[model samples]
Target chain A: MYGNAYIDPNEVNKTHSVLADEDPKLLAEFEARIERGEKIEPKDWMPKEYRKQLIRMIEQHGHSEIIGALPEGTWITRAPGFKRKLALMAKVQDEVGHAQLLYSAAETLGKSREAMINDLITGKSKYSNVFNYPAFTWADACIIAWLIDAGAIINQVANAKGSYGPYCRALDRICTEESFHLKYGHDNVVTLATGTPVQRKMVQEALNRWWPPIMHFFGPSDKISSHTEILMKWKVKMATNDDMRQQFLNMYVPKIWDLGLTVPDANLKKNETTGKWEYTEPDWDEFKRVINGGGPCNAERLAVRRNAEERGRWVREALKAGQTAYVVPFA
Target chain B: MNVAAIKELLYKVADDQLVIGHRNSEWTGLGPILEEDIAFSSMAQDKLGHAQGCYQILHDLGEANPDQIAFSRKADQFHNCQFVELPNGEYDFSLMRHFLYDHADQIRFEMFANSSFEPLAKLAKKVKGEIKYHVFHGNTWINKLSTANEVSKIRMQTALNESWNYALGIFEAGNFEAELKNEGIFEGENALQNKWLEVVCPLLEKAGLTIPEKSSWEPVLGGRKGYHLAHLEALVAEMSEVFQIDPTATW
Candidate 1:
């Protein structure tokens, strides 16, 4: 469910505003810890920008998980057999649970889960845009479970090496579970691709439909994207958008071809000389539009989440009625 | 042992689990609390897996595979009591139904654990272990929410009232009910129903909710004979929507 959190091309340029109010001595100490690969814990001193950026990154990851569950979750009832049903249920449950873990992780930095969720529903925060597109068929779900999760593991594995204690730990656990999801997804896609002609066509079409979104998943390349040198120095941003995308393509494209499913883009091939993938450029305009809420399922996805929030309000209220105090648990 | 009797018993048990499990799963991301969401999804997975376990027994007795039997059956061919097919209206209704139906199912499985039929007894025994948690979850929620607030109590009572008749249909006797009882394949529905009432009445009373009177109870029937409510057709269609795409595919 994780796609890179799309950075606004402008926000990166304004990050220095964080240290304008900080004691230069404390800022130097914070940088020294990050430079030495020490984890920045909750009680640790941090520049305002470090807290803000980590919260943004982790909260977006959490939102992606929950919203990501919706598209695949819809397939649980209709999954072809008991094996798929049980696995899909467990998989989607893991996604929601991941959101819980990640929200808690983000909470360690001082933002409340309620406030993070509020920003999500209000569109003040962004999740991976891949979810804003529909899972149009069973094969689409299969592709997501396999390919999108593949992308997440790529991004998350790199992020697990990050300097934040909680988010890194959460990513480690998340990657372990996502590995199984990758297996389940791969099994499903293999089944469809090797099935009857009708099924083969279905999976191929699904790949075709999803390939563009997958290409757009890691966000725009650094050459055309925001500069995040400060966050990188903090180890908060572990890999650039292009690096994660290439890692995904490098690992998955061959496996996708081995399944005998064609990549939708004719130009998709690895370069022997450059040792990198060469593919048609993902349309940044569409990525921008979708990330800004123009995709087919963006409205529907948020509305479903918003409706769940509204309908579930009374039960949440009733459960809270007798509780004398509320505490946000540590991640 | 009457094979038809055993198959009949299995169908109702398996169908109820599958249908209700499917309904319970609808709460996955939508539950009021995160813990409740995880709880409902876990229970849903257990119920569905239990349904599959029941179908494996049928497959040994020469039915189609579990997927085909489950996904290919027409709505009217389903043997689940209508109580389960009713949509999850709200958490109150869902929680109430879980409490009532699972109490009966728990006792039913407990009774079956001693069945003369060994395959069934084995499945029932294993299933009873999982149903323990289900009944516990149901009981805890009913107990907690019953006195939680005025609104919760009203909602719980109304859902209990609305669901009572369809719930009774869970005990509608099979055609081989007498033969099964004679062979000890299962205790008769009448006996199960009596025991179910004895167990449930105390909990309802403790929760300060009314038990619908026997004379007023018009137990809705025919679901055991493959009749169902309208909602069931739509549920079945949705369940098969993707599977029907390529019936022969491995997916």
Candidate 2:
């Protein structure tokens, strides 16, 4: 499962650059269509900015899936029994399939899958930072399947109402598949929670390890700016970072407590007055550091991806040798 | 029905499926392409499920449960051929092994579809359908890569040469071979090997890959009698790492 699309809070003009040269009439018409709740298809008249931002968002989202498969994929061999092994394999496969779909959606905005992959391997792009942390144990994998995917579903359910036609359609399908992931994850977690002392301790420790990354999942709250405003108006961003995170907390914190598990944050609870969950602020410093390639698994993750690309070069080259020029796949 | 012979037959196939399924799953996130990654995982799941199915049959015949039988065995106690226990050296080797192994696997299931053992015959009918797609996938890739270009063709050939003997080891006969045959519980390993050769040889030939000369056709043996390569031991340890934590606990 994926986190929300991570736009650098610092990349201000890069998001706003298309407004300077576009025809006002066309821009107005495009915004008007989105305002009327209509999707902006690939061939539709759009401001260059919309296409650029959508490409970045969708590409990063796709990259998240590809990288996300790595940590849990490692556990497929060591999963406790046939039931978990089969479930985890199919779940990780769905993550890869989600990458394919998202990549196709991004390709509709003009980036090729190869180009996106190159960016990912070269560390020129970003995926969900939670993946850069290790899945140190089977319990860790379960926490990811349950809580991380729980966050993704909240993020994705909001994004499914997004204005990009292909992305929305893809999210709709992805969300449906994610339901199974959520249930599978929850089942594993429940099994562990209600299980022996060893299992309970394992799941609790895993929860402690993952709580920080889970908090950073929706990303830091958006700074109010015209760029954010325009994207919101365009329906490109269906929800704010803080809003999605709050939705996650409001829905899940109680369930986590019911399991007799402690939230790593002692202050984690709902404010009966404001109706918003309150907690210690996550370390945005660590989030920024990890996103910038300083996390424990970043180098290893990229190295593995790059190695895969290098080893498969011949296969890809052999397939492409006499083929026609690449055509954008159907979204 | 000679239950001993049928149980022996089931053990070998189940062990092969479980071991190879474990090997193929190592490609979960590391395949040559995302599609191939997903494909191998899909096949891995199928193989694992098939292994579980066989173990379930064994369980019905008064053996331990599937989990105990699968996850509790030591490497030397397994019946899988040494071929499937080897590392996935590269995409080429893995693909080559897949093409070679799946063909033999499909034919074995097809032959068992008419077994006098009712449960074995029933499972064979269902599993044969799935193995057919596996063979089809292997064939499609072998045909494509073996003829794609010089580099791909040579890689495919080298992998084929290195893998041929081990592939032949897949049909290593068990002690129950004669009884299984006489009881009609199986067609016997010799018949299975001949039929596998008949299918794979022409396909490899059509793909422009050369079969090793008959003078060099010594099959690697002993896995059927419980000896295995160093790899299987480590693989078994790693595979059982979590289960062994508390085998009595429901994971």
Candidate 3:
């Protein structure tokens, strides 16, 4: 399960780090390759800004995968029965696998996985904000498996066409596995929704709680700027935040209604004339707060991760001692 | 066929797998590394499937469904030995336990593969293939970490020592062991334990870890007779928390 990479809106104006310093000839060739639908391989000549932004985006996506596992991963033990227990274990395992894949992809860009993980545990980097909210019930886990992953597919399927070769290839595999996760989640939700009244109430409440975060999952609507425009042209950002969010709504809102579950937003519907979805504006204030370390599970999530790192430090050091050198993984 | 004896054998084996699988699944997202996390979870799923396979045999023998049998059992009603119910103390402890327990499980399945009981023999044949990789994973990591450095070697040795007695509990004899051995449905626990030691002792020595002295080995018993440590009670309650919500409900 993943959410869109959260690009800080305020960083759009950092003129000092802009691509203006790149040689005009190389910059033109890079843009031309992207326009020709060529993937930017690891050793390709890319502007400094392109490399920096790709690292940030790909690293954040990887962190989101590992951190994302924490929420649903907790449910593996308490899953209802053998069917669910087995499925949940495999599902969360795929999330961890996704993190591994994403980390390797990011490693292609020169940042070591250890360095990226250090950034994650120290709060120097960010993952998807939706994970900061807790999965309060089994139904909450179901919602995450279904809707949150549904949103990720929407974001990732678009990015799978983006220019970076490794990230795009990683997303291609990720999207295939995520399709199974979506079906598993949807089946769980369907079981709950179509079952006893207690189950129905459980799923409905989970949906109510998760709806806002789902809306915020793609991050706030992008503000048009030179940086945003450049990333789009570079194929780093395949779609605007709102476009992906709208796509998610268009794809999943009907299915939610089909299950007889109500969206918490009264105004959520696809307008036939304008061909768009209308819903209550998500609480961007809360999104910013949560992404900046104030959400319900933020501290606990990072603490768990840090504790894992701390507990495993000796093993890491032991393995590192035997290694002759550090090798960057091939993309 | 002695159905009662066979069911007794099935319950203990299935419960062991289920409990240990539950313990292993707890490692999700928390291994020393991402690859290890995924490895544990994958093995966990295999364990759960193995448990389910045994439970399905039990269900065919007029037992409750797998979900009900697994979820409704109290800690005292379970037959899984206490070794698997212990907490995952650290990676060292967990890894050592994995190495010890998997070898035992693999050997048990190998013995079962040739049993007179056709259903269990067939299931055992399939399960043996899966547990093979699990043993391979356990052996690979044990060899790597145990030989890596002084700290790792010390930790691995300490983990082995702490887990030795509990690991011995995996073969706690059940009531039907004599009948099971005589009927050729399965060999008894003592044979399994002997073969387990023969298999693991050399591997541990090769990994450069010490086995606890024979004089100090006191297998923690009684879990085979519906007795368990308090750890199992909490594990059971947590495992069934959602299932118990609406017992008759499909979810």
> Which candidate tops DockQ?
3
lDDT order, best first, reads 3, 2, 1
- The ten-residue window of minimal lDDT in model 3 chain B covers B174-183
Q: Summarize candidate 1's per-residue lDDT along A61-84 as a digit string, tens digits.
A: 999988998899899988988899
lDDT of 1 at A319: 75
DockQ of each: 0.70, 0.83, 0.90
User: Model 1, B190: alpha-carbon shift in Å?
Assistant: 1.9
Off by over 4 Å in 2: A223-227
Runs of candidate 3 with Cα error greater than 4 angstroms are A15-17, A223-227
TM-score for chain A, candidates 1 onward in order: 0.98, 0.97, 0.97
True contacts kept of 1: 0.56
Model 2 chain B: worst 10 consecutive residues (lDDT sum): B1-10
Q: After superposition, how far is residue B42 of candidate 2 from its true place, in Å?
A: 0.8
Superior candidate under lDDT, 1 versus 3: 3
Across B136-231, the per-residue lDDT of candidate 1 in tens digits comes to: 999988877777788877877888888888889889988988899889888889999999999988999898888777788998898989998899
Cα-based RMSD of the predictions, in order?
1.4, 1.2, 1.2
- List pairs with backbone clashes in candidate 2: none
Candidate 3 residue-wise lDDT at B220: 89
Query: What is the overall TM-score of model 3 with all chains considered together?
Result: 0.98
Tell me how far the alpha carbon of residue A85 in candidate 2 is from the true structure, in angstroms, after superposition.
Answer: 0.4
Residue A260 in model 2: shift from native, Å? Answer: 0.9
